[model samples]
Target chain A: MKRIRMIALVAAGTVVASALSACSGGSEDGGKDGSDGPVTVSVMEFQQSRIDAVAKLIPGFEADMKKQGKDIKVKLVADPLTDDQFKTKVTQQLIAKQAPDLIDIGDSLVPGWAGAGYLAPLDDYLKGWDGWDHYYPHIKKAMVRQDGKIYALVHDTGVQNLFYRKDQLTQFGIDTAQPATWDDLISRLEQIKQKTGGTPIVIPAGTAWGGSTWTEGFQPILGGTDKNYYSLETGKWDLKSPGFRAVFDLYHTMYSKGLLPVQDLENPNPWEPTKYVKFPEGKIQVSAQGTSGWKFDWGPQGKAPIKGLNEKVDTWQYPGLRSGDAPFGWSGLGFGYGIPASSPNKDAAMLLAQYLSTGKPLADQLVSSGAASPRDDLADVKPYADEPKLLQAGKDLATSVYVPTGDGAEQVAQAVAAATELIINGKADGAQAYDAFLKNATDLLGPTLVKE
Target chain B: MTTIAATASAAAGPTGQASPKRRRRRTWPVVLLLLGPAALLIVVFILAPAVYGAYLSLTNTQLTGFAARDPQFVGVDNYTYLLSNSEFLASLGRTGEFVLYSAIIGQTVLGMTAAVLLARPWVRGKGLVGAAILMPMVVPEVVASLAWASVLSNNSAGTLNRLTGLFGADATDWLQVVPLASVVVVNIWRGIAFAMIMFQAALEDVPGELIEAARMDGATALQIFRFVTLPLIRGPVFLYLLLTTISTIGAFGLVYFLTQGGPGGRTTISAIYIYERALQFSQIGIGSAASMILLALVLVLGLVYVRLAKVEV
Candidate 1:
């Protein structure tokens, strides 16, 4: 009886100790990551569709670390919620100081995140990295935050184009050549409407459509305005200028005249019905879309491929606001990875992140999700060199600007989206929407941050 | 003598097998042993989070920006902002409409109808009928919403569209046109089975003589149902409404899946508004404040129901 009592007491004590220890979160040296143990670098990829392709980079990363005499293991963490929920999930984790080691963050989000001190500046790390010089100056410029510190590596970039169906243009007796000006573009839309009796153009609008409204729809047109939304020199958002008015005016024309499918823009998944379905079916003839329209959306491996989409779809550069001006395009937001300040193994994680940005892994991203590498040297690399169209697009980067997606840019995008939404819903016109947007932007960014 | 003793014993305590002092002494151990785990769970899981939420509501906690790093305590600002915020106010009205349409009228009425019809002796294949009625409850909310999304799709070849086409009408995207009503319809389909089961159980307990006497006294079926059947099942109906009202107010998945509170915020009910502010925009303080306000409203409404039902929480 005494022996049995002693055993029971020992068992109970063990159980209690176990429960108490379990309640304690974790320790760095408890076989997770320590000086002696293999460093476990947690890498998060927000896009579920691209998770597998991203995970394939782990083995290569670990092997590279081994050659450097570093023991490392890469663990891939996917966004628990939908891809749309990345901002929320990442923000929550960062604020709680439980962030994953390396994060594939959107370029627009870099300023806010880095400013908030969630991200550790990559300037020191990049200075040590020999491969940093290969990135184009335009691409490198996008990586700099408001603090003039490089916060991330720009892995991939894309440019938007005015995609029009060739068959529709032929049937409508429209010109096969690119429109020279905003008026010319509007006239073509009018002709398509008159000839086909369908909504002829849809530049993505509405809040649900998110940043696409600003980037794909309005950013390219900013080249025509001869003004930028944010001036690095003045350090002020140019809300008071006629630049925004000219851009919104075009949207007003598109929406007020029923040129675009406003209803489809207001839905949850904004791009699907209009860009993917109607555009492919030749119901809606013209749209402003990223290179993904051919590379992913209607590629052979796309969710809904249009037969001979590359052959059928014709492209036009976005025209200037005036009748006599140069057309423009951009290497859009440098979608790349940043090391979080709370990351356990920042050095190991940074190494993995930088590795994933170059060569075959970056090449696969284009095929997986239409991400074009900003590194100019990738043209000589086999996988990237093989994809001639992607290579050509990368080579064409010298002609375009890096779309400015710096401090307070996402809010600026939201303000633009909200104003565009009002226009699309017929609640406000161009001038009224601009005023509303300016007021909203001023309110959000503070009067000191914005200038009229 | 035996009856008096039994009455005395009953008046002593619950089991009435022990002396009053002894029973009182034993109750402490019983309470600790039986209810301690449940009490601990409730405190840890529910109460702690609720208290934390209340505290968070008073701060300027954000998910990003400088505020996310070290949140500042700004007392009552979020609540004041909520009072003046047009979007949040608009969502309250939308939520009210959703609850009334989906819960009070749609689920309760339709479910009672099913229960009444199925409870009749002449009704055939009661097992199949019960299963059919319960199938919606068996289907997960996400699955149901996805199926409905496909059914209410914009495609001309969609299920609902094809059915409408059969009737010589053109196909229409019902979700786009009637966003609120479309969600209400799906919510009704999802929740009706719960109401049916509750009402069916109540109907089983209802005395048959009262319903029969009304019918025998030259009363119509409708009159008998209204005067006799309804009064008998009033408790069950009240219980169903109380539960369904709260559930409908908190409905998120169905509406989120179908519309995501879109098409110019047409279907953005209060829950969606909270989610948008808290998670989407990363405005934690405002969302928490909104959540607290919603909680208070629910609590008050629950108290009102308790006053009417004269029951415990």
Candidate 2:
């Protein structure tokens, strides 16, 4: 009887131990107290290059936090991933309540994360923080959602426009002036095709590149329209807006006429060949690209930087749908620090984020990564002041168009991409593609939410 | 009759009744010691996740906030949604076609031919040829896909286009023209090696005596192979078919890198479909439903395969 009792006790103990181990919340302690031992703040980074840059700046942040009387220990969770993989991992982590204290949040992912309640609104924190005043109005605007909540701190801004090969255009006797409208742009593309007999222009398309086709390609074209794809005031998808069909028409004309490199768009690395290989060799005359393309792709530190590239390439604002509308570009915040709602060390995390968002750390990150800083004052700093090209590109921000941000915004972006892909791949005509897109949007966001 | 029973019981005594109890008590610890870790692993890694995933399939769980804070149980709504979705249905059909062409027909036929030819004693440099055939399978899937991407690219730099250029033909965009067929060909190239290795082992196991006996009976080489060799290897062939089919259905990395389910959703397999829905679109509930459907399809196919082939173990 004694032996049997002992065995039962041991077996029960084993099962309980195993259950306890399995049930443990993977070391995530909810932030209920802060006066314990050093508060560990988990920092998640997705991009490798950005991780390396951020890793170097963490010590500064930690020291600054320590000086401010917050004993903080920063745990770096740097997992390199592709854009799609990053989304899945971040969402899974956030849902499991295992998300890091501070995570890299892009402006594009802000609405989705904020709506999902994965991110904690930083409005309260920003109001008390001194760094908030230093941020430009556009930077502040880019980080806030339709709910009037600022979800993330602005670290870097992405400035994009139409980049053309000026020397090639001159050689082909093509006009180098800014295209006033879609017709003018099309005529110029035709001239380049007839004269150069190469790919006239290249815009990212297809399901491979995913949301970028909508952001980098369609949204810029959409920007030139009478209305945007989504209205922030009502938080609804404008699927039936003339801008929607016009964007599809633009793709239809470009694809059907072979003006764009339709075949190359299907390649896995669509941007690489066009930006690095074709653009340098004068095979592609024009591309809708970020203004930082010069500094990152064909500048001194770039991969396959061409000799005398500044003389070869010239940046122009992406044109409008009709004449008399000013050429505009798309600008948005890049990766910024956002504390997850489930963070155990929210206070410590916010402190570290505040420290890193400005001063030496921010300047270091911007310089090392070649990203434009959100702070206008940082431009007069050593590196930004020295680089004339960077300043010139930064000036395009005056005409930048910020996309709508709200719940279901990602779905809206995807709907646009699907429509554009349909027209570009010859799956459907503009009208048919528009109709299919309307149905897709209606299915995604119920008919009440989508203005079809 | 009572006397006979009494004598039998007297002979057996108490041992028979107590033996089973004694054996079970003695062996219980040993059973636990041996099977405990494996059982725990199955429960924790495989069974737990599968059960959790099945539970997730019945919800309105998305990657968005509603699903994040509180995932509502919608009870088969995800299944209904997927059923009505044309893209999901088309992807399922494409997956079936991909498995049939790449795994069942292409890899099996090509692998069997290579294995049979290489197994012959008269074949010279068999090792070299075997190594050459196994090259793609040995290389990592992602690396092989990237290398094949370069070779199969439609651009001016592509080897295929360059080769065609020498023949005075214009560069053919093979992948763009027929995206599914292109991925099928690439998958076949990568998979043929595994099939060859498996079939070659099975071919080698075929008894030489039977072949000689068939030959002695005036059977031709082909007849000897057909009559004697084929019957012996049918078991392995069926097993290979089962494994290859299941594996091919799960093939995502290679196809993902090569096409990412485009020109316009042509190459999107069930796995890619699940990924796009779950990860890209943040519709986890729908993705789970699709996954369950795929799992059921694989299971049904496997059951049918076993039943038809009458494979033992």
Which ranges of candidate 2 are over 4 A from the true structure?
A1-33, A39-42, A66-80, A303-309, A322-324, A367-373, A392-399, B1-26, B65-67, B124-138, B150-179, B197-209
lDDT of 1 by residue, A1-452 (tens): 24434554565556556656765546342234457867888888877546767877788888988999888887788764443577777877776677788888777677778868899888888988878888888778766766688777778777677888988788778896987787888888888888778898878788877666776776677655655667765556877777788778888988877798888898798888888788889988888876666666776777568898766787787887854567776556547788888777888878887788777777777657665668877776766667655665676666765545455566677688888888988999999989988877775554545765
lDDT of 2 at A149: 88
Please state every model's RMSD to the true fold in angstroms: 4.6, 5.1
lDDT of each: 0.78, 0.78
* Highest TM-score model number: 1
lDDT of 2: 0.78
Q: Which of the numbered candidates is closest to the native, going by highest DockQ?
A: 1
TM-score of chain A of each: 0.90, 0.91
lDDT of 2 by residue, B243-270 (tens): 9999999999999888888767888899
